[model samples]
Target chain A: MRGVSLATPYLHIDLPQLRINVRRAADQAALVGVALRPHAKTHKSAEVARLQLAHGAVGLTVATVGEAEHFVRQGCRDVFIAFPVWVDEGRATRLRDLRDQADRLAIGVDSVESAGNAGRRLGHTGIEVLVEVDSGHHRTGVAPEQAGVVARAAQRAGLPVRGVFTFPGHGYGPGGSEAAAHDERTALETARDSIQQVGIEEPVLSGGSTPTLAASLTSRAATELRPGVYVFGDAQQWELGIFEPDDISLTVHATVVSHAGGRVVLDAGSKTLGADRAAYSSGYGRLLEHPEARIVTLSEHHAVVQMPGPRPALGSLVSVVPNHVCSAVNLADTFWVAEPGGLRAWPVGARGLHT
Target chain B: MRGVSLATPYLHIDLPQLRINVRRAADQAALVGVALRPHAKTHKSAEVARLQLAHGAVGLTVATVGEAEHFVRQGCRDVFIAFPVWVDEGRATRLRDLRDQADRLAIGVDSVESAGNAGRRLGHTGIEVLVEVDSGHHRTGVAPEQAGVVARAAQRAGLPVRGVFTFPGHGYGPGGSEAAAHDERTALETARDSIQQVGIEEPVLSGGSTPTLAASLTSRAATELRPGVYVFGDAQQWELGIFEPDDISLTVHATVVSHAGGRVVLDAGSKTLGADRAAYSSGYGRLLEHPEARIVTLSEHHAVVQMPGPRPALGSLVSVVPNHVCSAVNLADTFWVAEPGGLRAWPVGARGLHT
Candidate 1:
């Protein structure tokens, strides 16, 4: 009832809290002597990226060429596509266009095949290639020992070898950040030593997540940190103790559409909250105010909430913190940003352009 | 490799199959001697709704007031908000505005509280109200015996009571459609008899799902049928024997962005297929061509698909049939309709305008 003007069940970001989150991350990274290259994949907004840059982020990190292109159009000069670059004839053209706009473009290479593809496509564009090493997240990236071989292959293919990077995604589990960051430091150091053993001067050693960044401060192996979700801490981060409740910035503002027999239905459904409940999650997500209420089920337009006490009256407004902020941001076209009392709309300029 | 377009990974509906699906549902409803009020919440496309009307659908069924308003603005005359309507002072004004535009506006009421709320807010507008009975889908609605009490309450508040309606949502489970339809018949008959016993004539009795419509043909209690997801049969319906592989009208067209060690990564992530995997589901969804491949995990912009044999090369195209089409449609802003031999684009006018 606090002047809820959202098209019921839309995401709302408190700008005041978001700014504080960004500044905190920047301040922490600066104190640790690591360049904060905030991953724009979390917010996927040029406005948020500008804020991160304004708060002292050195550059931006993205997952796709499309995302890099979007931020480049918004005047971002340096970007690193952190995922392994698998180039075909079509994507190579897009990469060429991206290189023309940005001052520096760094791509990740995990295997010799991808290195050859990048080199063949890049020609003489002088694209900087980073050998992706498998830290603990076994999803992508190469083994540390193999990083030097891929880097040598990339150099042979006419691409400039930059350094090595890894994502400590396994750090998200309960009490795993410290161990995972330790593993990250070992992987980065091993990969860097391998590259150096091959006599290639690798400069950037990048690694970090919201969970592992704090633990990464004592390590000298990583020179740059890329933490995306820290700017808008989510339910998972809160549960992992990576963030406190007050650190959460973005929330989905929903209206109570139905109430019957201790059950409340919110207008925000899977479309707003997203359906990314991790295996460790107790429920779909957590409600901000109604902590006792559990989001039992979600359809396309209706979120069935199970309340512990009497049901909320119809038309009551509530805020939901999603299990994963990245997926939630991808579901909406735009989100509202408020500075405590003054809320302004920020279009998610690159919400669904997921190429 | 097929000519893979560089579009983002997500769901894409084949226009030709969509047309065939629309015609089949309309034809089946006509044969059953019941009006086909095709639910537009599945596709959420005004163009699809127009095709449904052209194919003999009498009206449209929407899950939200925002959806109903979207269709009405696109020239739909009769619309029914099939979900339980809960009115407060603020929503009452919007409901009145909706009543002013359409030839007939109908809402569902499942409880005495909702009936009172509707009556207090909508009495002057003369909007028709339908009592929602349980009919074995225990998600929402009231018991059949309670229909009379709700109807009497509506009448006392000076609101017009139309009839009764129920959704056989249990039909979605394995071999549950036949039993669910039988339950639907009993509930509709009981509600109708109870309403008439109260000295008021019940004009309508509506119930149906794609799986139960054939079984419901023998029931004279139901005056109309509302089936939405049949327009775009999904993997769930395919497994339930409700639709053949050929009957699947929508598919997510995705490009292989990465291939390594017999693993392929798709561009279509949870944002496209949606995170609606039922407990019985093997994976996030099913691939139409590569049936052996399983979508093991989905990040925001990437889907890790594990193939049984050697992986498809990067840039290869694949089509996937999502488990639930409704949530997939909600994630997209617009969809391309590729006719059998022609091409056209249709805006999903009500993609994210959920209130």
Candidate 2:
């Protein structure tokens, strides 16, 4: 690997800035009296997970059993599969094996059928099950009122039911965080009550999203918070005023290949920076050197940047903050860590582990 | 490693269809009396490159010097870097070394300054250069009128100026094949004249895209065709009527993770299927099992498929045709080749060779 200046279209992660972001999230969670389970899906590196754990993260939240297995192998004692995964025979066997490896293993089940499937596949395996409740996202999870029915199905299969969880994904919109947090609180409370009706008391209510993490501090009903993107502030978070540009720890360094016709073309494109256009996003990515410049279009390996004034010189390096850092991280195999000495390369451990 | 029935969100490549597609392109190029240089960026696999060469391809086209190096190491003799790359000192040295490895090596130079830079850095390296001409696709390349200027710069720098090339990318649009082919032919003719003015007579003229390949048969001035996506038909090509459903050799095998409401969530998402939505495309991908089903929304790991009829049962496998095959192939590390007897794994030789 070359230095950050020469490795154009490479993901440059600022270690100092990453430490600050991790500490800030951990401190906030401590002040709110809620256990912080920073999502591992954001960085997907054991090195970063160690930093989060060092900063007082109770555990790590993952998205798949494959990610859980990867982290468990890396000595992550506790892991929660935050997604409502459908467990077939193969995945069930894997999850059973993962439970033996991890000190604490929890999974989300959004429906009664899913709960039954999991319970039948991993009954009495010391795997904690969390029923997912729809807190206005409506993508996954069951209704808050239906939590008892799902918990009953898990109990019938001789499994342990821990609590309820919800993701306020709708908070990722213009002026929607406050309302989304409110919905999260209401849904978790209702789900906790329904879980009690199924004879499970003091249920662990979990809810959080990057946009609603601050609002979640006021939610007394929530006992745990899971926010992934806060650790690596992206272009979306910066534009939403949730974090400053300086807080963005990761950026894709691109070289200006063409500088003509009031436009600059960078070597970075969808394959490097990813193709995630948020509803409020102005462009595909934000250039750190020229904040006014917008990446208007992205082909497989070419990003067309519309310059505000004069374009940068050809072959010069320009840092770009991706719209979604998670997608960008997922695309890259290695990240060049920015340090005082120079740069270091770290492999993205859980990349391409979608299964 | 497993069968398609168990490997969710896996790239299933039909060997029979791929062989047919490879033979067809080679035969068409032979009939037109033009050398076929299949773009390896589509599959990024040495296995696919072998298939192309076995069917009479003259060389392989790639988007980066890294890809060219990978193919050379995999025993590909003739390789062309078809992108106007910005080469720093480190890359210039690598190019020099690569020139010694490949029997024939050429790099794209679109600007007079790039030509000058390449000439100064790689002078007397025996590396052939091709001037890129804009054929109505304004993404990159110099105007046809400016080709002589770039060629002269390269010639002055002691670099071998062998040809001019254009990618009719605008032909990807709806009903744009005929017009794009016309523009491609006109641009190449003009660029050839400009090259002749630079005292390089009989310079090779190259142009091709999957949409305009048929119409390109009428371009007598063109001596070479470089089409990438013809090897793997995608949803965009099917929508354009360029390929039938049966011609789609590559598909993402996704399992139904969630069956709820009017939608079925597939294990395949943007991370698996890729986030490439063409302007004329309808959905993220097309389901082969349910032709009417559309992949409406894609998170990092969950694809929400809106079904027109009854949803597929949970855990059942469904094949999805990605909107862009190149993007999908780039995202995958391995392709599961579906043979008549069983499945075999092939590493994507240059999956992340974006230099």
Candidate 3:
């Protein structure tokens, strides 16, 4: 909303609120005696990662080797590729380079063949491999009972098996975060048992998503938490009752372009706001100025807002909180950071780095 | 399907197929005696635009001012910004520059206020404005009868009202394209009569979408067709029975990362293969190799495929057709164009230019 002087449909961050979130997450993780490696995919800025590190975040968690390489170049010492990435010759070379650049680097592996493929190229590089366990979401990852088999396969491939991890994506829905957190701990504990039975000692049980972070810090079962969206509260977190509107640090600055047929059309649409409307999400996003407004339809560059009351006038600026902040951030090349003094642009580094 | 040597999660275009689709579209437009101004937002590649022009496309249609500037810089002389853009001081300056560079520049205006704003800034620059009429899709544009009122408003603001345009976006569903095309013609014809009532003779009746392209070729209604996704057939078009599987020219080169729970996981997920799923879309996307596979789930870097038969082995390559080609192309920086001899990289020149 403060980006009035700037153009419409630009991403901006409230630095003070971002810092508040960073400190809050680190303090909460420390209170429960669990390590915090915040996912860098949400902000995708080296500056934001620096703030997380300054607040006692252990390292960074990324989904792609390109993201890891980016942060490593930005001087991040420890990095983890949380997704079960398939390693081919090209990706192996990139991972090897990242391994050489960073102090500690790890990747997730869920299958024996992928473990073998990665171990053959990255085993000598001291890259630790974590077995991914399916908590409940069932998108990826091995079953809790199969963790031991994957760990043994990694060991046979001459790669070090670090621990087991699970993403409780189920927490993002209508089900309460407590239930998903319980399921996360259950799966991680079972996977730990399976890994220990396979002769792996003291496995690090990693689990956490933004929706489950508050309920995920069980010191007895979990060693680390990887919550991405807490730093920048999105529409999903607010609608799920996990965060307040004031906790949202990032927003898209859009303008009222059309006020026709008793509806308001904003300049921001799916391309600008990112086309990520979760089933549980209230709308495409939340209009900060008009909380009662619902974005019923989104074209490529037009957000048709259905307001409960009077809509804003044309040419006026408003802030929009995207449903999925990570996907939204990926659509922009750069974002403005609002400091105590003024705003400055920062590149969305590692954007379009899907590989 | 020929990006075998490249990495997974990269976009590749079959040049021969692209050329065939381009020629077919041009030929159809010619047979109907209508103008073809293919939307460049689908591919966003200068090479693709050049191919369309070579095949007799009148010009290019873009969605944003930044997209228009990108094409203008790439030597696309006649470009139309199809979205009803809100003109602020910053966008006005950019539009002014684009109007200066391009041979013919036009923008869509659905509201009288936005038309006045654009006309005040760009009137002297020789930019044309097209009044958008609601032709079934209630997203943007004015009602058919209100077209005259907005046309008179634009004329009063010192801007040339070039024509009336409508997007038959409703055609992109299972209701079938023929009915939507009928609605498009009816709306455009009514809008034409309204503009004529305002004393604007022979107003250009511009309308089209990929879903309605086949039925859109009526000499009595539309003057120009702006079908974007026809060049690179998407899963939505294929599911709606508008395009066949072989008509698809672009596909995502993804690799099997895991095979768990009777599902195969690919490295290309929502981040790589866009997150656009129409209600009528079959699934998240269609696999080129395994047409029976349905993309059940998508993580940041994982596309969980539920196949009826045996899944592809881990580390094997597969091609994926995204649900929306434009959104998918917006996610990649560059794509490999498979030629008769070899492949060449073409930058998605207008990537991330979502003003």
Candidate 4:
């Protein structure tokens, strides 16, 4: 509390809690006989990725070719770009550069167009292409039946097809992870059957979220798990029963700048907590200390909280639980990680490197 | 749009529109016989500050000591930090350094605590302190009656009492700026009279916002205007009728990544458009060309836009009108100014320098 100086608002990571979360995830993945490929996009820090690797993560998952390039530059060898990539002229060049640097580079291909593009971009490069199958989350990925067609297209284009992958994003709601993992098993199995029916052997089937990773291992269809936000549990994870409050690793450390009209405004705002409120989200996010306090609104530099109990005095430092950890990490330039005995700064290495 | 790849997800500033906005604000302030002190927090570009100065800005206003330092480094002569700064030991050192650099430096003081802190830190440096009066926006500042008390407190602490400044931020809503400006005038006049009754002549009375500037001029109580966001009018300003779409000087150039289910996802996401959304905001923001298309949601690197009509094809480029241009600027590493013939990159000189 004494060291709470008013600087730019930032997310603080409790290393003890983060290590526990990582161990729990690794243990769960091992129990299910699947490898954990923690998504580096969540933290985007080489330091956190190192922790995941130390905890038995086989590889790391990234969202973009730029992110893959960044992590690989930071000495990460195996990187999977989990998002369905559409390789245009500029992106194709960048993807080639990333593929050359990474030890094992795999990209998600959800459509014939993307498959063809990847095939064209990764000519003679031996880049692995994962058929993205929709397991419930309709944001991306092809239908389970269409996965084989996309896989065949990739194979025909001279790219090696690496089974299938699906994101159980639907598992993030109340009692949704188990059902989502069930859906993932069904989708991945169907896709695998379709690929075999075409005389192609699928090598990998990956699916998992923090909530679904435990349940997903019940199915032999999944060979690997890619859970990103699990490394830094957030308010949404806590609300969805994916994590306990003690399991929450990341929090926004902010000072109360003003307290009036039963509302307290903290120096942390959308720039730190991020704007990732779902319809079921209690509010903007949760407070670590005062769970009853709801973040009613967030401006650029102020998070307005309606205190259910006693208001924190002006200048009081409070920890905020962001609704989504990944987005929050992107908002910050760097994060302070309090490892057991020391504090260190980790640059959100790939933040805003969307290009 | 060939050869117009002005860098994806970067702010595109139209010099023509920006010059017009500056001239218009200056003409309005001149007509009202009030000096204009354009707040640099919106752009944070010294180049823009110079433009405002050339367009007749008497001085410049900033939100933080960091911004004041930045402006002073850019050779700005007069700078006023409009926020009530709580100076600690380290910041006190910075404040002293800033005082040495600037020809005229002033900071807002709304509480006795801050006044005492500033006085103690300043140590007879003769730093000018302006009492921040709460006209309506309850975010910060003291009540109108408390302005005199705070000024006297500053005087007692040996800090030079300059005058009163109030931001009619609440005036940003629908048909609210005019009423808010009226309230600002009444509050400042009452506070000035109170200070005068105590035999102290308040030197300056400042109040302004893009929405309230016109109304504020009707009241002669305010002698200076501080409008920041008008230089790059955003979707919020357009919706509030504060500025027309043509008056919008800045835009986010993003590429369409996916088009499916009557929705088009752009590469911009929250990192480019920013996560700032008011209750009255149409959606996250606006698409410059596709006005009917509403940005329904944003993840870290993907913006899901629900098209009102036909969806754009993938790989198509688009310009987004962010809800708040200031936040969008903060999210980017650099901005591109599209001049007559070519594009020039300007490092968001003060980005992530917030303290």
Candidate 5:
């Protein structure tokens, strides 16, 4: 992103790097012979989603109904809300609208009660259902053995059961990818068998996370993979040893606003860079210019960094890789991209779609 | 907010409580004989800023030029960018525009070099400067004794030195408010004397935080008080024992999406409620209804709560108090306010103005 030092505290996306990252993930999925359904929760941009589709993604996975609506409005035909949705009357209305807009719509469910409610509210919408398997993450999903219960519930409610899916969120830590991959395969296989007992054979077993995408390829149980954050590797990915620093496509462009000796303060802070420091993550963020520098303290609008060597002068521009790319992207309204011609802006279209 | 369960994960504001909170701070400032410049960084809403003005506020305080411009465009005459800004050419143009728009424009400066740079780029703008004094917080300010050095530098650069200010951010901790208040008074007094030594008498001494506002009233060194989060008491304020449960005016309206026994999950998480858990804060956030519940884990869009007793049924709406209200407010585009007649939507006017 040359000649892009015009502002501070703006999220900058290197277009060339972004394209390379997108293609690399698609190539990995292709090599493994898994159908890639890239999750849009990380970038949340129509431009990025279109790139994923162009690179041979089967569909898009989203975390919320609002996000599904956003991508559908942007002309994405096949969309899956990858969250265990609690469909109330309001969500039923919105999901019905999304069903009419998209060629294919799917949602995750972990319990019989919620599946029954979704079936009651949206039976005519013909939205496909995917039973969420815990897969050792134990977050908003049923145990692998209980997947058939929710699948039968969906089927009884006239909602067609498509497959089973899991997040494998445990993959995002130190020495976690290998074990998480093993757990994902075992859980998906068990869920598929349980679902098959209920007469749904050859179920689409979807499993993948950025940290365990390649490791998960060891098993052939997963027919589809949904990996977010692969489009823009972040500081956590670097610290977890899952990604090279060269793979980070997005960074916060900040200016050194204050400093005392080797202590530097950047204009970018929690408000811009996001405040998500995982237990295994090294720090709040990392400076691309000074790899040894540590962002010691982060408040609303100030990121304090301790540099080992000479610090940058006040007003000197720096790029920061956020610890969690998804949360950081959610904080922004626009993405500043370095195009071949010049700096351009793309809307973070689904940024605040909290519902 | 009554009859406002149309959606989940939306921020809800109790209009009556918000008014009460605003008037309470105004009354405290009046009784303390200090000019109250309510920081708009908390709400970032033009309607809330107007309410603060109606409660006898002197002006509005912001953290960025974009924020200052937002308030100014909303018809606020006087605004203070209460951050040690490092002005580059782009920021210089923006600050100059702000000076032309605002009736009274002031910014913070912490270093002589930045003061000179601002002077070079915006000398003729007639913008006032406040020398930032480092209280016990030590985040981003010069030492109390160095206040005069920066003040003199601002004067040399043709920028009018308007006085000194300190954040006292350390006040937001358990049993830390009292000592932080004492430190704030001492820092302001030492800074006032230091600025006086630089030939600026009757400098505007400003120091205050939500936790230290009442305690700092014991000292007469401060001529102005700035408290941002008092308008919407949050989990942090409650944990610090600075606010009563009744003082909380805002909450996230979420739904019980999933549950297994007492292990319930809400459809709100870090993306909506924010991920700002301080060392002294209890959990990721607090549920208004289930006060004893522990939010065990938080993901992008799921808050896992381990409740003690009988839990709310599936699809039941719940209220969640965010750890930090400012960050939560920033994550939303619209504020659902319970007006007397009905619910109303107020734009989070300055949302995502990162630059």
Candidate 6:
């Protein structure tokens, strides 16, 4: 594209590939009769959100209230904050305004104390609260049986107990998706049954991760799926066998600024490509054009790539598929979308919304 | 302090401590009879740059041309881009404009090919070009012996050969600073000889890294030092004995949103604290209040903290000193400076100047 030569480090998103990925994920969720509430935390672009919605996404899932606010302002009516938010007075005020703006809004609650805080602050506001149940990730969430306790606390505090959700984050590791999805199903099922036993029925169970999306089809209790990074396959997904190299929709276009010996330095570094590193990642990222090259080290503004035999000349542009595409996208201010003959710049709408 | 309840994952920089760190680095540079050119890549704030200049910084050192442009636009009279830049026609045109704006503007060129490119593009502009020599960090830079070859090439192409510069980046690892500084001296001295043998004399040899700045005093060849992280000490510096716990000026203020057993999940994550993991890091970062706490894992929006014995209550605030302060600062839009009355927000002026 014409814009490819404008800068050393720029994010490029293949519009066609991105659309295909979105359609495929939506189709996969449809096949299982589950609503596809694609996580907007990955792209953080309202444009990408619209694409997902057009591809049959029911609503959108977000990680923070800031993200929810961004999407809600962009005309997304239904939104869910997927994290166990600690809603203080300030957040409660924002939630109230968001509820007034959006048609439907939901938040996650894993503890009775936090649920009480949210309920007391948001009492009689009709804000939907989902009990987050720990499936296998052990990051945040209550035990499957403990979901009923949290839901009851929310109910007592006058907040509506809508459903339960779990993130099979352990699916990220090598070949861990199958078992994580199984744990996700069992946990969601137990959470749903426990809530039902406590007079809470018709709970909408939600579960899915990019790595375990295919396996989520087997989740009998989960009513919806929320996969974030499937929209833009990264080096982690490719290395983990979740996505093929051809499936990567986003890549950072970087210039080889320095060529010495077998190593080359790119203008892109941690600030541009993100510092997200996985245990299984080969390096910081993979050079798309030169498969044999590995970005061995990254400072704030320099990525040092080591090549096996033939290294690209200095000033040559190389596309890098980041190890984690979500964090990478969050770092950039704009994404260059491939168009007919040129690239169109789209602002990263929800960047730095870390509240 | 009131703002602590407003945002969960906000960056807090102690103004008093930051001033102290600036003064100390300047004093150290003065003691060693070297000009202090603090790297702006760490904070990316023009306000911070003014602080460094006030504390006797002769000029500013940047990692990219965009960073140089950002600071120059903010009235930085002198700037040096430390990375070996690949100046194509567009960048060269920008460089000429930058050269006109600043009293002195310099760029690094490590290879003859790159030197030729820069020389051809930037010839007759009186723009300074420093040959980058590799000390110990195998990331970038030419060998000490290759410095003359590149400098000669630049001279032959009508570009002024200023001197050689080396980054003691190998100083980052555990107990590597002293040796890396020693290597930096040897490399720069050898590079000086290599250039002088080819008729280049009185070369303004420059070298420094936060970890090796103290040891740079032993380097008789280094005429100036560029230490970026000395402005905001991090967990890596504390772990490496580069600074004490009291010296950490910047910290990520995060709230514990979930309490699950002994581990609590904070709203801060890789997006807030940065995912710069070191082999010597205790975890992702160190907590200022709870010294025994370790941020064990990070998703994009959640930091899982493993505490010993006691843990903070849910919704309580905690200060986290990141593993790498530079990367952490890059993620935030504003730095909340602690004042006598309250915290004041300062925009990160050049946060994403990665070009």
Report clash pairs, candidate 4: none
Provide the lDDT at A32 for model 3: 78
Better of 2 and 5 by DockQ: 5
lDDT of 2 by residue, B1-355 (tens): 3531455778999999999999988887888788888899999999999999999999999998889999999999899998888878888888999999989999998898889889999878899899999898777789998899999999999889988999998998889998999999999999999999989988989899888888897675679889899999999999888889999899999888776544688888888888877778888889887888888888888888887767788777889999999888888889999876688889988988888
Worst 10 residues of 4 chain B by lDDT: B1-10
User: In terms of docking quality, how is candidate 5 classified?
Assistant: medium
Cα error, candidate 1, residue B27 (Å): 1.5
The lowest-lDDT stretch of 10 consecutive residues in candidate 6 chain B is B1-10
Task: Give me the chain B TM-score of candidate 3.
Answer: 0.97
- Please, what are the lDDT tens digits per residue for candidate 6 over residues A95-154? 999999999999999999989999889978989999999998998999999999999999
Instruction: Estimate candidate 1's alpha-carbon lDDT, on a 0 to 1 scale.
Output: 0.82
- Model 4's number of clashes is 0
- Give the CAPRI class of candidate 6: medium
The positional error of residue A287 in candidate 4, measured at the CA in angstroms, is 3.1
Candidate 3 structure quality by residue, lDDT tens digits, A42-100: 88889899999998888999998889999999999999999888887778888888888
Off by over 4 Å in 6: A1-4, B1-4
> TM per model?
0.93, 0.97, 0.97, 0.93, 0.98, 0.98
Candidate 5 Cα errors over 4 Å, as ranges: A1-5, B1-5, B260-262
**Poorest stretch of ten by lDDT in candidate 5 chain A:** A1-10
Sort candidate 2 into its docking category. Answer: medium
Report the C-alpha lDDT of model 3 over B50-120, residue by residue, as the tens digit: 99998888899998888899999999899999988877777788888888899999999998888888888
Better of 1 and 6 by lDDT: 6
Clashes of each: 1, 1, 0, 0, 0, 0
After TM-score superposition, what is the CA distance of residue B252 in candidate 4 from its true location, in Å? 1.6
Instruction: Give stretches of model 3 more than 4 Å off.
Output: A1-4, A218-220, B1-4
User: Candidate 1 residues A222-254, lDDT tens each?
Assistant: 999999999899889878888887879999888
- All models, DockQ values? 0.45, 0.54, 0.65, 0.36, 0.64, 0.68
Native-vs-model 2 lDDT? 0.87
Q: Rank the candidates by DockQ, best first.
A: 6, 3, 5, 2, 1, 4
Q: Per-residue alpha-carbon lDDT of model 4 for B144-188, expressed as tens digits?
A: 887778788788888888788988888979889889999999888
* Predicted structure with the largest DockQ when compared to the true one: 6
